[model samples]
Target: MHVVTTPTGQIGRQVVEGLLRAGEPVRVIVRDPSGLSAEVRERVEVVRGSHRELDACMEAFAGADTLFWVVPPTPRADSVVGYYEDSTRAACRAIGARGVKRVVTVSTAGHGIETNAGHLSASLAKDRMIEETGVSFRALQATAFMENLLWQTEAIRHQGAFFWPQPADRVLPVVATRDIAAKATELLLNASWDGRGGVPVVSPDALTPDGMARVVSEVLERPVGYRQLSLDAYREAMIGHGASEAWAQGLVDMAVAQNDGAYDEHHRTAVPSPTGFRQWCEEVLRPAFLA
Candidate 1:
């Protein structure tokens, strides 16, 4: 059986659907089964509890050969790294106890240069904790997700502008979550590959924030502008939106690391995934903005 954690999330939802399409037996660990569609609820075995609970994971991992793991965001936590460790500690123990054969996990692209990267550093640390379990692991090392723009849909729709903490002209790799889910599903289904490694899931286009604005404008047929915010302002904005101080600071640090070329090493060597910036903007962002 294939076990999926965070099955209700953007990426994990797609992973679950992909597996179901292939007629694979699937199990999911979710806090609220109601978050799942009725069709999905009827299709897969649901273990109702947080994946961070050892008993829950042990229950969900039972008779499961492959696992799809994605850490759900905890923006209210006091410490970002501590949240990640707390979330993964139970799964690590459960993996050993269940004797799961393979693990496909969501991880960030900035592997080596994660100093003060906040979320990036935490994700890398999560990867290490999982790897130590010695299961056949594939870390889907993803860059900035284009879907993150969805968070600003209201601002973009009302003001025709988007804001970020990175320079307007700095080129960076961004990916679509669909591509990440596809990669995760593929890895989870195949049983031949062994050993721990990272698969970079980056889109073909490495566009600057300005270039992305242009694409958004062209796709939506409206003039949209990109504005760079200071790190302090960004942190304050996140905090103002109800995130904890540490979580907001973690976002600021992640933006700083991105601006400092954290993902450059992986981008330089990655075989680009299928999604392109324009395609994602046209298909995903355009619909989101109109909605």
Candidate 2:
């Protein structure tokens, strides 16, 4: 049986779908079972309670041949570092105790790179720790999610511009979430024991703010422009929106890193997915942009 920690998240849902397609029995770790899709809710057994506690979650993981581990951090958590460190450590400990052989994880590339322990640093730190769990693991290193554009929707409606953190022409690697999901699912379903190490899942193309603007404008037939904010401007804007000072500043700093190529390079050859930016625009972002 396969056990999935986040059966409802963007990538996690796809992983479950992939397993179901193969007619494999699966289990999901859930704090509450009601959120699962009826198909999954009915077919899969739920191991209730938070994964933050090691023993309970490990018990939930027992007897699973493979596990899909994902953590969606809470922005307003009191201690961000401990939240990740503890939760991820718990996952690793459980996987070890349970002797689950194959593990697939979704993680970021730049986080492993030297830099921001303030924010990026802790994520990279924890990712390294998770990799040491001794399971046959594939940690997907990906770029900024294209879905982050959704954060700009209300602004696009009111301002006719995207107030991004990087410079207008700053090219950052951006990949579709569906592609990330697909790649993750492919790894989980294969279970071929390829005996490989970390896998980097990147899109065919890396796009810039201007590049993104061009796509959006062409797709939506609107005058959408890119406006990159200064670090001070970014800090003030985020703090004004109620983010704690440290949280707001760290986010701005990370954006600067992305713009300067601090998070670029160190990628793998593409394993192409059915979707691309334009198709994403035509299908998802276009209607939202038009709306």
Candidate 3:
């Protein structure tokens, strides 16, 4: 059996779909099965429980061949990666006991310092814990998600410009979550995988924030500008959007690193994801922008 955590999410749902299409016996771990869409619930065997419970997690994952694990976002937390670390520890302990041998985890793109990269910290914690389970594992180290553009929608609507913490010209590798899910699904369904794959599934192409706005303008046939905000401006903007000051600053920090080309690891030119940001924008985002 193949089990997926966070299956209702944008990427997880696709993974589940891919697995089902591949004729794999499917199980999904969800907190509230009743809340799941009828189409999705009908597609798989549901393992209803929270991952925070160690024994519950192990039982839910029992007899599974491979696990698609992801820690969903919690923007309200005080500590940067503490929540992710704790949750992953629980999952690792349970998976360790259950003798499940293969795990595919979502990890951040960079291998930088802890506080400098909170997203990186979350994945690093998971990588450390899961690998020790003696499971043959593949940790997908992916770039900034293209869906992050959704965060700037308000600015795009109100100001005719997209505002962000990073400079408009700083190029960062960004991948659609759809692509991440597809690649991850491929890896998980392959039956045999090399040990500890740190696959940096990046965009076949990279773009700057302002360049993205230009594409948006072209695709939507309306002028949209890009504005790079100061750290203070970013903090206030996040606050305006109902985020805590520290959390807001932490985001600002990520953007700052991006501006410095920190998460821009494009060395694996041989390794490429099939879907790029432009295709994703034209297909998925353009309709939302037009609407």
Top candidate by lDDT: 1
TM-score of each: 0.98, 0.89, 0.93
Better of 1 and 2 by TM-score: 1
Pairs clashing within candidate 3: none
Q: What is the TM-score ranking, best to worst?
A: 1, 3, 2
Quote the lDDT for 127 in model 1.
Answer: 91
Highest-scoring model, TM-score: 1
Kindly indicate the candidate among 1 and 3 with the higher lDDT. 1
For TM-score, candidate 2 versus 3, the one ahead is 3
Candidate 2 lDDT, 74-160, residue by residue in tens = 655555555567678888888888888787777766633455534555566567776677678777776677788877988877888
**Residue pairs clashing, model 2:** 116-121, 117-121
Clashes in predicted model 3: 0
Off by over 4 Å in 1: none
**For each candidate, what is the lDDT?**
0.92, 0.74, 0.77
lDDT of 1 by residue, 1-291 (tens): 999998999999999999999999999998899999999999999999999999999999988899999889988999999999999999999999999999999999985555588999999889999999999999999999999999998988888899999999999689999999999999988989999999998888979999999999999999999999999999999999999999999999898889989898888889999889999988998887787
Error of 1 at 34 (Å): 1.4
Query: Candidate 3 on 133-250: residue-level lDDT in tens?
Result: 7888988878888888876666677788877677777776788898889888988888777577677778777677878888888876779988878988888877787776656766
* Residue pair clashes in candidate 1: none
